[model samples]
Target: MTGAVESPFWTFVKQSVKSLFIVAFALSATSYTDDVVGSFEGLETGLSAALNTSTATTPKTTYEALDQSLGKGLDLIKICTENADAAGFNIGTAIGWLIAAAVIAFGTTLVTVIGGAVLIVSKFALAVMFAVGPLFIMLLLFPITARLFDSWFSQVLNFTLTIVILAVVMAMATTAYDAFIASVDLNSNSGESPMWAAVEIGALTGVLVWIILQISHMATGLAGGMSMAAMGIRHLMSPVTGGLSAARTAGNIINPVSTRRDLESGMMASGTRFDHMIAGNTVINPAYRQHVMQNIGKNWGWQKGGSVKN
Candidate 1:
């Protein structure tokens, strides 16, 4: 016995059910789901606390962790700057070190604040995407709407990668700061200036800033590329839309009443003979061409055969 082919609706239903089951299983098996859900819940709680003129009691929230890390990094810079004299530096060298320290401190602050804000925003966006992911998956059930799902998935992936990159970069910068602090010998009496240490810190800060900028550029490029792809897909689908429009026009042409009414409307609405001909109100003949030339001559104050009127 031969098997029957499934209808499109049933096929879509089966695919949707299978996809949902797979997503449910994957979510249950992964810690990432918990992290996203927890972060969203934490955000809600934090907002509520702020609105009530209270403080959030949640420990190790994403923002709290970022603040703690940034604070420690700043503290390390403070120690280096504050104890510059303990390294047996002369007054001039000490002054130089302090200047460098000030610049490096400003750079560090800028990097940390911008990086932390990006990470926090990206994480929250990821959580939001996850919340609406099922709707996109359902959109994927139809070929006509699949591009919407693709665009959604691309954005979700971009946010995820951005968050991961920012987190890793921040962690590395923090570790580098801690290591630099540990390497400083404040008790040394060898008359060595801490100016070199200040230079190293400044260089590290510059490098960190460059890395963050590169990551931002990369994220923007990815989003821009996805947008271009989506536009291309829409361009490709234009023919389908045009075909539907053509079908409506054909239906109008096939009905005698509609055809007569459309011709009358076209003639009444047209501003020139060319417009009437183009709108199917009249046939394109020598008379229509001569009429167009005459109208153009009148509008431009010119005679036919390329002669201008005085």
Candidate 2:
């Protein structure tokens, strides 16, 4: 009886209905998968952009300031070298040693400056890698990026500090060498012999090198001490940091748009400054007047007409 009820048209219709159901399900699944993929891609793009912007505004400024300071130091060094005119030296060996010391000092400065520049660029690279790379996704599992960034920044700061110490040490050494050479009687008619001059130059170079190494060691020790102190402070502040992070997260969730806008405005305002050059004396923006007043507080005794209060 069941077999007798079957018709070719009805059977074809049944098969067509099954096919359409399958097609519908497949299309729906594909659309859902595409939506999920698109959402994830958008999230990654947004995180990458925000992280990159933070990096640009922070360490980039510090690096640029260091670059300018190092450039100025180099100019000062050049001026000092030019002023150190060796007027009485006739011995070839003595002159050669002075030239060698000058070259070494210059080379040392260049190497330190270049290394600092490279380190600055590496900071950006580190931020991008941690922000965008899937491998660093684990950082978000517990959000360790803040601590990591702080540690890296501290190390970079120590590196810059060491460079400054090195520059100061070199300047002192150069000055001392010039003074020592000036005191030496290099005249041919004087009692000093060429052999004695050679010995003096060798001894001076050795002393200078040793002094530089000692200063470098001292600077390294100081930097390490500072790093240890910073670590101790960070450890002490861990609970506070966690509390602040939770509060920030809750605030973001409550009013994300307003919170973000306020944060952006604050960052922009902090960096904005209007300068007016009046009679070669620069006057800063009035927006910062309150901050300056707060800092000066009781020490601010000036009247409205630029007269000091008695």
Candidate 3:
């Protein structure tokens, strides 16, 4: 009786350990990507401080380049044509490591699930839960469409770029909003054209919109990471369920019903919805870029004229 009680508890502890490794592998998979993303963030931070500091003179050339690439004449597709090697990872290395990690994680979980299928109720559910993530990655990286992965990766990279671009736009809008708000003395003057006031409203509102979108993007990424962690841990804990398999249709019922299909099946049943949520949204997706770009375009015109046009 005590053995029965103690068995599942040990199993849960074991699965928990495996989940930690999933995060470690995922981080490594996208290692250099972050550096590239971070550099752009650094550029943005520099820009934000450049105006008050004497260094603005030195960066005038850079600022000009930024202004040009990000403005009206921008051809969005140019991003892919001149793409850099993914920051810390070569396309080859990231692919290799990521593939290997999935294979190992899946295979390991498969063996455990097949052998342990009759132990616990949660294990049956967990076995199904864990299979989801790696399967998505495998599908995304499968050879025929692997090239598309680069495009997808680029899309995300571009999203990162949009973040920097959006930051700059907000900076300009903020400057304009403040100037507009400061110039008008509502208490002192009669109601003048609310156009400048409207610009203030528009800029502030635009910044708020961008902030919300960016936050959503970040939240999705966080969800994916958490899903991976949870799946990895769940697999480690629930080694046995009395069933045919849980990874596929027959397996989900477990016990006299199913068994895990493969390592992928044992490890993840459904793609981590959270991870998918992250994968689905990119900072540089056309929608996001278009939003910021359109606003910037409008602001660019307005900045040039310092007035509204129809």
- Which is the leading candidate under lDDT? 1
Task: Give the worst 10-residue stretch by lDDT in candidate 2.
Answer: 271-280
From the highest lDDT down, the ranking of the candidates is 1, 2, 3
Query: Which pairs, if any, clash in model 2?
Result: none
Q: Stretches of candidate 3 above 4 Å error?
A: 1-145, 188-310
Q: Give the CA lDDT, 0 to 100, for residue 295 in model 1.
A: 54
Q: What is the C-alpha local distance difference test score of each model?
A: 0.58, 0.43, 0.36
lDDT of 2: 0.43
> What are the per-residue Cα lDDT tens digits for candidate 1 across 221-298?
766575545444334445654665676567546532222213433233523444445655444556545544555545
Residue 61's lDDT in candidate 1: 37
- List CA RMSD, all candidates: 18.9, 31.2, 38.7
lDDT by residue (tens digit), candidate 3, 1-310: 5464455444444444544443443344453235433444464456445533333422233234233322311221121112212313456443433343333233323322322221232233333433332333333323464344344333333433333334344344334434544664322124333233334444444443455346335534643344343333233345543221244345333423222212222232333333323433223455544544555545344334366589
Error of 1 at 266 (Å): 59
The model with the greater TM-score, 1 or 2, is 1
lDDT (10s digit) by residue, model 2, range 206-295: 554555455435645665666544554245445755676687678657634311111213322221111122211122435445444545
